[model samples]
Target: MPDLLETVIENRWMVQPNHANNLDTAHGGNVMKWMDEAGAMSAMHFTGETCVTAHMDEVNFKQPIPVGDIALVKSYVYRAGEHSVRVRTRVFRENPGKTETELTTESYMIFVAIDEDRNTTSVPELTVGSERGERLREEALSDAP
Candidate 1:
């Protein structure tokens, strides 16, 4: 069994001019790519196998992260089926100097584990082994689409 909390991963990407859209904010595609990478990492870490994205739930851009801001992406495995892992990923706009952060985008991603032969493989069950893990799972469930 894999503990859900152990699958958590976080990454920070500086929103640069190259990542900006015409609005001078992070592009939606770039944000989604970051979220996907984070989510895939969580899934792969949990399953100890190569994981590829199978599906993505509807994503929402609640706020735009302007250039010079940090896009903080966090991901964790909340649930697992026989061969698929469900990951919850969220991006926040962060101002490091002021220590401020706000939600920018969120979505659930599903990934399927694969083996060296490129075949789907069974994954270990996910378990919530601590209070914090339980709380995080609950939060993801509540925010699910």
Candidate 2:
């Protein structure tokens, strides 16, 4: 089994003008798109097969990403079942020097692996093979303020 930390994926996207809404901030839809993509990447890393989103537990937008800012999205598999993997994703804004990071959004997504025929397939048990993996899993389960 691969360690969740090793399987963690990070995706960065520039908040482009076209991706913004009338408010000049990144559109909520664009943010959700990036989150889903990042989460799917993490799920595929853990399952080693194509995975589809079964559910999105919650998505809270606590802050807005501006056009000149960069959105850094990180995702990792925190828990896995027979055919499902629960992934936690966090999005942050990156600005040089300032080094400020705000948890703009977070989501807990469930994905199920699928075979070539598009049938759900069982995935291997997840193991926190490293201290970092264990820490990430613990963080994922922690209550959000």
Candidate 3:
């Protein structure tokens, strides 16, 4: 079994002119693509198999990340079913040299493990190895609809 925390993934993207919209803020589509990729990574890491995104829950753009800011995407697997992994993904706006980050977008995504044949396959059970892992799982569960 893989610990839930072991599946956590964090990636950062600098919001540049190409990623910006007319308002000079990060485009919604770009943000969504980043989130989806991060969530898929988490799921694949946990399952030890190729994962394909099956569904995405309600996603809200809470704030706009302006150009020159960094889009920090974080994702972790919180739950797993027979062949599916549920991941919670969040995007934050971070400025260089700043210790604090602001929430920009959030969503829950589900991915199905896939075998070499591209057929859905079973996934191993997820475990919480430490207090932080337990807490993270709880927090995601509480946030669920």
- Judging by lDDT against the true structure, name the best candidate: 3
Error of 2 at 121 (Å): 0.3
Candidate 2 lDDT over residue span 1-145, tens digit each:
8678866999988888998999898999999999999999999998999999999877889999988888989999988899999999889987745777777988899999999999999998888877888889999878432
Lowest summed lDDT window (length 10), candidate 1: 95-104
How close is each model in CA RMSD to the real structure?
0.7, 1.6, 0.5
Q: Which model scores highest in TM-score?
A: 3
- Distance from true location, Cα of 53 in model 2, Å: 0.6
Off by more than 4 A, model 1: none
Arrange candidates, best lDDT first.
Answer: 3, 1, 2
TM-score of 2: 0.94
Question: Quick one: ranking by TM-score, best first?
Answer: 3, 1, 2
Q: Which ten residues in a row have the lowest lDDT in candidate 3?
A: 95-104
**Per-residue lDDT of candidate 3, residues 1-145 (tens digit):** 9999999999999999999999999999999999999999999999999999999999999999999999999999999999999999999999988989999999999999999999999999999999999999999999976
Candidate 3 residue-pair clash tally: 0
Which is the winner by lDDT between candidate 2 and candidate 3?
3
Q: Estimate, for each residue in 31-51, the C-alpha lDDT of model 1 and write its tens digit.
A: 999999999999999999999
Model 3 pairs in collision? none
